[model samples]
Target chain A: MINRTRYLTQSVAKILIWIGALSTIAMMILILFQILREGLPVLHLGFFLDSPKNMGREGGIFTTIVGTVALTAVAIIVGAPLGVGTAIFLREYTRESKTSRVIRFGTDCLAGVPSIIFGLFGFVFFVIRLNMGWSILSGGLTLAAMILPTVISTAEESIKTIPSSYREVSYSLGGTRWQTITRVVLPSALPGIFTGILLSIGRSIGETAAIILTAGSSLVMPTSLFSPSRTMSVHFYILAREGISMKMAYGTGAALILLVLMVNIIAQWLINRYIRHRT
Target chain B: MAMKEKIIEKILLLTAFSSIFILGLITFFIFKEGLPLILKIGIKAFLLGEKWIPSKGLFGVFPMIVSSFWVTFGALLLGIPLGLACAIFLSELIPPSVGLLLRPAIQLLAAIPSVIYGFWGLIVLVPLIQNHFGGPGLSILAGSLVLGFMILPTIITISEDSLKALPPTYKAGALALGATHWQTIWRVLIPAARSGVVASVILGMGRAIGETMAMIMILGNAVKMPTSFLDSARTLTTNIGIEMGYASGDHRQALFATGVVLFFIIMALNTLAISLSRRRVH
Candidate 1:
């Protein structure tokens, strides 16, 4: 009887695990199916080619796509160097001291702060107080700050993962700390740093509430850093929430879904390639 | 050469310190703008009052506080069990080959963006709730469901890491002593990973509470205490997401105050999560 009960319990546990895993997969399928069903009818060549017409009530999100790409570009330009710099400092410059602890703690806090709070700060400091207005520059700066923790942590991790043997070899050759970092450590850690940047790119593209509040959502094609622009996520949000055009909203939503999938795939590919190269 | 190295070091240090400065600046800006309004409205009224009309000079967020807690608690209820189960399966039950595939799939779920989740909830879950149960469909249930899904990745990853971190000796000892596979997992492994599992739940709670766009789309955004799972309720984050666009005067500052409240809550949760995870490491 005891043996039989043990058998029954083991089977029950197995079923529970299967149910959990399958449910996760199932939810993904359900979301994908619903999005494709409602969104694909409106997705077409013209939708991708044409700019918004009548404040996004009609027309494709060509301009919106351009805007998203443009904002992400600015964000990378602004965020990457700073993020990498910070990571280098954390990993290379100092030992595990109070300052390093404080920096890490701050980064963790920044990571946990909701995107909307970031939005409020960006709106107040960047847009209003700094007189940047609702522009791609403002939005990009905010996103850059928002994603700094992610980039810094990942970059720091990558730097830490590089075995100390390489650094010791460089130092033994009479190379200065800077020389060793720039030539040996940095090169070896490039792919990992790049992994962080790519992940940040995905984040910058998908961000909405923060961009919506800071980057004024204009339908016009963005031409300059200071020019106001709207992202695909924000475009989808404004359309769906305001009930401007459900068809366009669905189209944009579908496109947003596809964009996220593409970003995830590309990022994963880079990470995998880096891992394979390491091995 | 020494000068050049020194200059590079200084620059790197400056950049490294920027995040700390930014944190201070954000806290300063939010408080500088928000606290005055809270003072003007009186602390008691702002924290304890029940109304939320900006145009009417009423900026009470007590209902929103209640709503945020309940929704997070609800999401935790829906997400933790499934996430823990999934973690166990990935770490113990499944082979590494299958674990590799499903693992990235979970991360992919995390990367899908909140706006998409909100859109799905709006389009699919809301109507399902409405037709099947009642009350315009945008209830706390929908919020919990969507937010629960949003947080699954975080919970699963952390819990799996915790479980994997356990030394295999415990499992071996249990099995050698005639414990069933299920008993080994239930009696031995899960207890050892307790700190990590608790940390995951706390972190998941943080994500669920901080989520704005999805909650805005699903929760009916009604400013009231949720009496049931089906009741429409507004979260603190959703309140800001919905109103920060056009608010003016004290209304705008009150929204900033709303942000202050949110920032504090998230900070607390982050601290708790950090402490818990730190314990796990030790």
Candidate 2:
């Protein structure tokens, strides 16, 4: 009887564990089904290619899509080099220095700050103080700051994972530290750096609050970096809040999700391909 | 050649070091804009005042603060157990092949933009809550549920990683002592990974509090104190999102102050999480 009871309890525990594993798939499917059910009917070619006109009565999301891509591209352009440079310093140049520790602490603090605070800071500093006046530049720069910590930390980790043997070999061959890092260490850590960049891209594309405050709600395609622009995330928020048009909002949302999903899929594919090649 | 190369390397290092200075400048800008508002409103009135009528020069954030905490607490209560269970399942029970397939799906959930969550919540979740709970189309319940789903991925991923990181010797020892797998997980593995699990939950809490788009979409945007989980509520992030458009004068400053409070809460939670994780490392 005791042996039978033990068997029963073990079986029950196994069942519970299986249930827990399946729950993740269940939740993902549920969310996908719900989004498609709500968003699919509104999807169309015009919705993708046209710009919202006269309070979003007509046209597609052309302007918003362009704005999102442009803003994200600008943010990447501004943030990536700074992030990569900082990582290089932390991992390669400043090894064991007090400045490196301080830099790491600062990056961690920056990462901890919430998105809304960044938004508030952008509103006051970028829009009011600098008189940038709610343009794509302001939005992109604020997002750059918001994502810098993530990029720096991830990049630093990737760099640190490189084996010191390669650097030592180069140094023994009379190579300077900079040459060793650029020629050997960086190549070894390239895949990880790519991963960091992909993650930051994912973050910047999905970010809404900082962009909303810094980039004014303008439906027009930004003619220049200094002009105001509306990202897909911000547009989705504005439409939903104002109860503008349910169909348009849902369509725009689907587009935003599709964009993010595509980026993630591409990143994963690249990482997988790189790993396979390396192995 | 050596000295010249050294100077170039030092210059590059200085440029890299300047990024930290840039981060400090950003933080200083936030404090400079927000501190004056906090000082003007005074801590007592800001913390204790019941009203949040910024239009009338009343900058009371008590309602928003309470509502933010209420919804975040509700979300935590709903999400933590489910996330932990999922983490345990993934780390201990599932076959390797199945775990591999499911891991990407969980990561994809994290990749979904918050706006889509907001849109879905506005169209579906809010209406469902209103029909069942007899409130307006927005409520703390709606916000919490959506926010709970939004942070679910973070909690599950982090906790599962931590659980996986635990040394296998503990589990082996437990099973060798005639303990069931579940008992081993609950008693030994979980206790060993407690700091990591706690960090995951705290991170989720921070995410929920800072989430703007989804909360604003589902929380009814009412600046009133939530009487129940089903009542319409406004979080600090949602408040800033909803009102930053046309707010001016003291009203805008009050929003800045609200942002300040939100910042500190997140900072505290994050500091605790970092220190706890660091302690676990040692």
Candidate 3:
């Protein structure tokens, strides 16, 4: 009786494993279907081009798209250089010591801090304390901080992958540490570094809570960095939660999903290419 | 040249410290804002008391705390079994060609924005749960379902990596010793990858607990201890996200206090994960 039951349970576990794997695929498809089905009907050229006229109840999302692009641009400009520098410093400037361990611990903690906490930090530090107010700059700065850990970790991993032989060659030629990193090492790790940037772009684009607190939801088009604006994600949140118009929300959701998938695909492709190139 | 390189190194070093600075600022500012409320209200009442009314000035996050744990527990119940099974399927059971197709889907699941998940959950899962499972539908069950899906990628990826790291010899030896295929896997491979699996589950737990945007949508936003999976609940993340907009003075501080609690929970989980993975490597 016990052997028979064990056999049955083992077979059941095997079958359940198939279910688990297939269900993941089914879930992804279901999400895509729901987004496209509800959203595609309302999407049009006007929806993409026109600005929100009545508190996102009517018209398209022209300004918000621009705001997202501009905001992401600022974040990339601020975060990318800092992240690359930090990765270089961690990998090259010092040995793996207590300082590096602390930095790693700090990065891990930063990565795990809830998005809402980051939003709170941005609200107090940027919006109120720094007098940036509800602006794209504040939101972008907040997102930079949030995505910094991802960038640092990825960039560091990529930089680590570059063979030490290249650095040794540079040093044999009497090159300084800075020369070795900039001329020989960074170029080799460029694709991987680019992948990190793209991943951060994806992260910053999808982020809502952090931006919502820092970037005040303004109906009007933003005029400058100091102007408040709504992102597509934040816009979708309001429309869905407020029960404004499910049609528009679905449309925004669909667009946002497409953008994210595109970004992810590109980043994945870049990573693969980098790996192939390295090998 | 030496001077220029020294300057370059200094700049990079400063930038390297920038992330640590940001982390410090976040912890300091949050504590600066949140500690006042905790001190005034006393730690016990703040953490353990069972009431949370901003207008009445009664700040007790016990309900939200319990709700957060339950939701995370619920998510683990759904995510871990499926994720671990899926990890085994990919690493040991399935062919590479099949894994090639399925793996990207899991990664795509990770890349999809939290708000999109929220919107989808609001429109699809919430109504489905409401119809089938009853209640408001936007309850602990719905949140768990969404969170379960959200953590699958994290769990599956790490678990699969750990499983893959095991030597083929282990399986070969088990089969050589007259063990059946399933027995070899069940008894040997799983026990070997235990640390990675635990780390994956802990990391997934961190992801589930800290998730804010998606949780806010399907969790029904009820600040009460849920008696059942179908009951409405609020998590620490949703509590802060929903109220931080217009919250002023002590109310704002109270939300910061909620963030502080969340920080500790996430920090603990991350530390545990790092230690587990560290041990696994050794």
Which candidate number would show the highest lDDT if scored against the true structure? 1
Mind giving the per-residue lDDT tens digits that candidate 1 earns over B1-282?
A: 999999999999899888889899999999998999999989899988899888789889999999999989888887998899899999999988897678878878988879999989998899999999988799999999888888999899999999999999999999999999899999999999999999899889988989998888889899987898899999899999898888888889999999888888988989998888889888
* lDDT by residue for model 2 (A1-279), tens: 976787688788777667755775686677667766777778888888888887775677889888888878877888887888788878777677788767766777677677777888888888889999999988988888877886787778768767788899999999987788789988887877777677778888888988989988799778998899998888878777888877777777777777777777776676666656655
Q: TM-score for the first chain of model 2?
A: 0.90
The CA lDDT of each predicted structure is 0.89, 0.81, 0.89
lDDT of 3 at A122: 92
Best by DockQ: 1
What does candidate 1's lDDT look like per residue over A135-224, in tens digits?
998999999998898789778878888989999999999999999999898998887888888888888888998999999889889889
Cα deviation of A143, candidate 2, in Å: 1.0
Of 1 and 2, the candidate ranking higher by TM-score = 1
**Could you tell me how far off, in angstroms, the CA of residue B201 lies in candidate 3 after the best superposition?**
0.9
What TM-score would each prediction reach against the true structure? 0.97, 0.94, 0.96
TM-scores of chain A in all candidate models: 0.95, 0.90, 0.95
- Give lDDT tens digits, candidate 3, residues B220-259: 9988878999999998999999998889999999999988
* lDDT string, candidate 2, B97-156, tens digits: 787667767778888888778877887888888788787968898888888888888799
Docking class of 2: medium
> TM-score of each model's B chain?
0.96, 0.95, 0.96
User: How does the DockQ of candidate 1 come out?
Assistant: 0.77
